[model samples]
Target: MVEATPELTSTSDSPALAVSVLQMLRTATSVQHKALEARLPLTHADLDRSLYTRIIEAYYGFHVPLQRHIDQFVSPQACDPKRYKVAALIKDLRALGLSDGQIDRLPLCCDLPRLQTQGHLLGIMYVIEGATLGGQVLRRIIADRLGIEADSGGEFLDVYGRDTGRRWKAFLKQLADFDQPEYNGDVVDAACATFASFERWLDRAGVLL
Candidate 1:
């Protein structure tokens, strides 16, 4: 298990030893994270191409509107220009044999987590950016089991590829700025909400095995 080190950066309002925002967020959200991961269909023992396609299709339905929701709150500079996640999903879908029209016809997730404040936005982004990092492992698993690679049909799995670790560290660095005392609740709550929203969306999409 990769452990997060909590560095204290306290305001006058905060206790002297309060955990760093990233570590706090991680401890708060770990249960939801593991629960969601458990329910994902990616690791099914009987995994095959058709199941993989449906999984990617389900992801497209969720990721499209989810990224749009994030976009509604993100400043231009806040979003990494290289993080063309929706575009990567499109590429994977195309490589998996879906025409653009079929992709357009896929049902989208509507009930999303609320992004009401900077804390909320940060919380939601924490989940997303962390998932992008986790996808590096998933990418390799898909390649081994399904014979799919980034060039073929699994581009979204490791969207950042070799830069995944660097991108994740960059994201973690930005958390330092939001280490104020008051925003912790908002951040943690939004992360939990994001996970709940995603699980509900996945349930409706019927992609989990």
Candidate 2:
């Protein structure tokens, strides 16, 4: 775990913490972000259902355990458990023909980092919530290229639907409210670790090009 520096504890305001943490980790997170995007097999001229299924399966492998861990530490009022992506992933997986048994047996991601503080929890939520924003774009691409609709195998990507932006801003407000000084380092460290762990998990699942 990376140590929180004195500088990180400088803010108690939501907007300041939000700005500071993002500025601190922007470069690190961006690298991991671009790497994941580059590895997705969406550009092929002959993308198939099997390939798309594999992609969702890999996501399932990472998110199930990841979200479970996040939920454990996240405040009940911070995020609605009902809106988490794991359920959508399960529905989409089943829609793609994976049985309940098969879904249960899907390979789990290894070496996921643990959250030790509210800041750490929010950091991980930052990554997950941020993905929903990009998912809107990915959902459109999947629909155009793979013909999967929000009610079908693409539901996971269609998270928040028309309210994606609103949900994201709400999350930011929640994050801002977590402006305690003690958690500064944990927040930034967890966010960076999340991006790295996600990249590693995706690589392990063979989803990267």
Candidate 3:
């Protein structure tokens, strides 16, 4: 087994450390993007949305009903694409080594309820802003690593990232103002767990140093 180095394990509340993680993810994404570009047989190819749509269906279809209760807090326009179902995304999630239970509760962590109204709105905002693009970047990373061409996979990243990104950032400003430290910590922790799983699988696949 490839062991994760201490550098990878280190964590702090320091913005530096958080920025480092984000930067590392960005580097990984760039590498994967280059890999896909090199392997794709064609340039200017649109990503296959049909396959992308299935990936959506797999993940969100099951979670949609559960998330409906949480949706009332967010604007209809804001939450619309957030509701897209992606089946391949969920399958790829398994390839990233998330446990079934962890994957199952994943939506709840994003669409938090049973908290205050601001908390609920914060959860939606946090997820829509912070989580969705991260999720797409990850899918792009996987598709690229697997040598899936633009004709087959690029649309998943392009469409999902571009569309959901605007709302995500809009909600992020809203999320930063919410004062519930405990809930904020929970949200951060969930993000950490998900990313750690991604890193772990990448390490296992020998894609990370």
97-123: candidate 1 lDDT, tens digit per residue? 999999999999899898889988888
lDDT of every model, 2 decimals: 0.82, 0.78, 0.42
TM-score of 3: 0.37
- Per-residue error (Å), model 2, residue 67: 2.1
lDDT by residue for model 2 (85-202), tens: 8889999999999999999999988767668877888778888888887788878888998889988899988878988999888877877677555676787788878888887887
Report the poorest 10 consecutive residues by lDDT, candidate 1: 1-10
Once fitted onto the true fold, the runs of candidate 3 whose alpha carbons sit more than 4 angstroms away are 1-58, 72-116, 145-159, 163-166, 180-209
Using TM-score as the measure, name the better of candidate 1 and candidate 2: 1
Q: How does each model score on TM-score?
A: 0.89, 0.83, 0.37
Mind giving the per-residue lDDT tens digits that candidate 3 earns over 1-209?
11222333334754433323323323333433344334332232443434333333333433444356445556667755644434434554454445567557553223223423555444333433444564565556547555653344343343345567676656555555554545554444433333443333333333232
Q: Backbone collision count in every prediction?
A: 0, 2, 14
Clash list (residue pairs), candidate 1 = none
Query: lDDT: which candidate is best?
Result: 1
- Decide which is better by TM-score, 1 or 3: 1
